[model samples]
Every structure is written in structure tokens, then in C-alpha cells.
Target: MSRLAIAAAAGLAALALGTAGASAQTVVSKIKDRGYVVCSGSQGVPGLSRPDEQGVWRGFDTDICRAFAVAILGDREKIRFVPLNAAQRLPAVQTGEIDFLSRTSTITYSRDTAVRFVAITLYDNDGLLVRKASNITDKKQLDGLTVCLQGGGSLTEKAVLETEEEFGIEMKKVYFDATIQARDAYFAGRCDSYVTDGTAAAGQRATVAKNPAEHDIIVIGKGTEPNGVAIAYGDDQLFNVVRWTFNALLWAESKGITQANIDEKLASGDAEISRVLGQEAGFGKAIGLDDKWAYNVIKQVGNYAEIWDRNLGANSPLKVPRGMNALYRDGGVNFPFPWD
Candidate 1:
């Protein structure tokens, strides 16, 4: 062949290879190549995502990570939890250091556009936690009181400033690195109040102190905030996997489904149950996952209510009552998207 003809042939071969590569490449493809999904969790937040003495990870955030793992890898243990600090969480997801982040991250406009949050696994609101002895029942009572907060973050700092301005409350902001330290400072009388998410306040109160109830921690005011998991932007397939996994959890809970009842439901041959478990027609194919992806999540990680009650229930240290987090059927805001 002539030199020009040879060059043209090579270009055609390269074009074919590029097309084939593009066709094969997908979020699930890359995730499988890595062997395990990289999940970002907190460095140490007791009931959210913290390591136990035996190095086993548990809590609501950990469960969220496990749910994603089961959805993709068909095993809850097929994830490596990357414990991240508050500042490192968003950066880690943005840089692709982790496949998904379950680190009690709030879904803010900036983060959604920048880092891309999937479905909100947990919905949370900001509230103040004040020591009962301070005689603070409401925001007005916080006037002239020193409130300890996790400093340097634009979100928390702005919330504190807004609280001060809106409520006409004078608050001295004492910065701390972690909630544990802040809670200690508040208990030790270094600060009169601790301002954080209501869920976090409950967790801190439960984990620290000899008897959590002995020190009356009051939730002063609630703010409108949506907290959830975050993943990288532009990967629609991965986003669908994450979003559907969360919805599956809520859907299962709404339908009175549990790990124990899952097998029974599958065997019962109910059309809705069959569709969810992927025993009939599978919905996972639409999301680029195995037919039983949702089944794996429910079987391994349980549902939304199960996760919440396990971590923040009365028996758990946090003892957080399911207020706004209750299912929509129970008159709360938690409504699962339709599976069909």
C-alpha cells in the first residue's frame, strides 16, 4: 500500500478503537475495575459514621455507604470507608478520591452545583443544643450567651451569624474542631451553649457525659436545611444508582419491608414486591445495575427507618426521636420516589 493509504487505514482503526472504548466506559465499569467503592465518612462522629474498638464501622452514614456498595457490588462489605474531616469531605468527592460521600454532608446549592449530591439519604435541620441548667428554652433565652460552634466553615459560621441577627440574640462564638470537643467545652462551662444540627446534638449528648439525660440539652430553634450524601457531578449512571438506592430504602420502609421480611416478600410473588426485588421485571437495568441491585441493598443494609432507628433510636445512645424524618405515611417529609 502507498504511505498515504497506510496512514488513512491507521486513522480508521484508531477511530474504531475510540468508539469501542467510549461505548464500554461507564461509571459502573470504573467502579468494578477498582474492586471496591471508595466511600467517604466522618473521621469520628459516634452515631453518624465512626469506627468501633474492633475497627468495624457502623452508624447511619456507614449504613448509607454499605447500601451503595450492596447496590453495585452485591455485598455490603465491598466498600472502603475513607474517614474525612469536615473540610476534606467536599474536596475528596470533587477530586474523585472517593466514589461517594456519606459524611453527614448537607446538601447546599454550592455543593450541589460544585460537588453534586445524590438523593438525600438523611434529611436534617439545624438547631441549637444548650445545657438545661442555662435555663434556655427558646432562642430569646440565648441572648448574651456564648455558643460554641465548629468554626471556619462558611455554612456553620453563617448560620450562627444569621441566628444572632434574626433572633436578636447576642452570641459569643467559640470555635472548635469537632463536635466532641465543643460538647466538652459546653459541659465544662467554657461555653453556655453548643450550636449544631439537631441530630448531631443528640449524638454528642448520647456519646458523652455519664448520663445524657442528667445534663439537659435543649434544642432551641430549627432551621430549614437538607443534609445528604454527595458524589461527583456529570455521572448520571452513578447518580441514578445512588438516588435509587436511597429511594429503595425508603420504599422498603414504607411498605413494611425489612431484611427478615425481604425473603418472605420475594417468595410471596406480590407484583410490587417482585418488582422491587427484581424477581419479576428488573428496574436496575435502566440505572445500569444488576437486576437485583435494590434487593441487595435492602437485604444487606436494611431500609431508611431501620437505619435511623438503629442509629438514633431510643435504644441507641443518641435516643433521637424520629420527628421530621418519619415516613410521609406517618405525616413527615420522607417520601420515597415511585419505583415503577
Candidate 2:
């Protein structure tokens, strides 16, 4: 063959390969073209994903979604929050109804294999909520008792059932649509126990009953689950975007970086923080985002600790301690993957 013909054939092959690479990297490009990120959250859990009196979605889960928007889209407001129930969360992500689900979903082997968990933002555990007057302190005392549960294939129910068998007890299940309903039934003595996550149990108990202190909704038994956010499986581009976005938040918190300190730190050129925030090194570019992706997230949404403190800390009505949610430095299991 002529040399010119050979060179032309090689150029065509290179062009075909470039097209394939572009198609493989379509997730980020598609999201940017859409102009917004659709995020799934819960309807109304006071400190988790409820709308305030001003009609704005605010909570730990909501903050995570907004952070993703800031990272990928560079605008915290460039997100649409779709409130989904426990059952709807997985299907929505799988069907592409939303880009991601930041609802308080527990990551499990079944869920991780079925749906995709981008990152574990929060570590949660199951606990029992009972009226102080009921005097049910331990799981052993609940044999043959009625328990209020949110019963539409809830993992919380499964966790309770597993615990019941482990403790050699039997409890009746009374189904309720929402935690509020179940809490009311428990407080009114309609059921003997309320089974849910420790944070959720505390949030529900504090909402009703004049003084939460008057009701002894203790966290009985060890936590049976780990909660986190969900993304669609098999989308490597989107998964990395979501995963590293979460890691950036946790890393910032671990390094004692806050929204207030982000600007000064970026200007000061701290090597570690700058690299993570994409100020000194273009880490976001490696992850299919602009260099300022992490900076935008920290500036707009704050870090993981800030979100936890604002929604579930001592100042908030939930008043739950960090416990296992604290950073590794503070004796908790929240360790961040190295940005490098």
C-alpha cells in the first residue's frame, strides 16, 4: 500500500479510539449538559430532610446532595431535591429518575449488590424507643410484646427481627407509615416498643412527648446497620464524582477545615488542604471536575462535621453525640481516603 494510504488508515483508527473514549466518559458530560443534578431525599424527617417553614430542604442528607451539586456543577443551588420514601429511593436511582439518592439509606450487602452505594456518609445503628413509664430497659424484657415499626419492607424491621431472634424474644409488629405515627402509637401505649435507628428514635422521641427526658427511649442492643448515600451502579464516572465528593467533605472535617477557613487556607497555599480542595493541584480534573470543585463544595456546603453539628448536635433538638460518627482522630471510625 502507498505510504499516504497507510497514514490515512492510522488517522481513522485514532479518531475511532478517541470517540470510544469520549463515550466511556459520557456521564460527567451528560450531567453538565443537563444543567442540574437531581438528588433524592426523604419527605419530612425533622433533622434529616424536612422542609423548613421557609419551604427549603435542610438536613444532613440534603447537605450531602448540595455538596455533590457544588462539586460537579459548581453551583450549590443547581440541584432539584426529589423527596422519596424508603422503597422509592433505590428504584429512582436505578431507573435514572435521579442522579443520586442522599436519603438516610443504610448500606448493606443486599443493597450494595443490588443498587450502588457511592459512599458511606454516616454510620447509623438500630435502637429501641419506649416510654419511660413502660420500664422496658433491655431487649430481654420485650418477649411477646407489640412493637411499632415502619413496615413496608424496611431494613429497620429486618434488623429488629434479627435482634429478636438473637436475644431469644418474640415481639408483635404493628405497621405505621411514618416514624411520627409509630412514635405517637408507642407514646399513647398502643404498642409496647418502637424499633428504629438510634438517631431516628431520638429525633422522633424529641418531637413528641412534652419532655423527652420523661420518656425513656433508650438505645437497646448494638446497632444493626450502617447508613449511607446511594448512586446508580456501573457508572464509574458518576460514582467517582459522588464518592470523592463525600471523601473531600470528610477529609476537610478531619483536617479541621470549615467553610469559614476555606478561603484563607486556599490563599495561604497549604499543600495537603490545597490538593484536596483542588487549589494547589488539579485533583478535580483527574476526577472529571473543574479544579475548584472541592473548593466550591467546602465554600457552599461546609464539611461533614458542620452538617452533623448543625442538624444533630447539642445545639439542635436532636442533641445526639458524635459517638461513632466522629473523625478517626476523635476516636471514631470516620477515616477519609487519601486524595492523592
Clashing pairs in 1: none
lDDT of each: 0.79, 0.80
lDDT of 2 at 68: 83
TM-score for each prediction? 0.88, 0.88
**Local accuracy of candidate 2 as per-residue lDDT tens digits, 160-207:** 777788899888899988666776788788987887777777776677
Which digits, one per residue and each the tens of the lDDT, describe model 1 over residues 1-340?
9999999999999998975575366556787877788888786777888888999898888898899888888988888888887778888888889988888788887778889887776666665666666775677777788888787573656667777787887788899887557767877879887777767767877886566765555444435667787888767678788888898999999888898889987888678888878876556777768889888888888888889888887658787788778887797789888865
lDDT of candidate 1 at residue 3, scale 0 to 100? 100
Off by over 4 Å in 2: 1-27, 177-181, 187-189, 220-223
Clashes of 1: 0
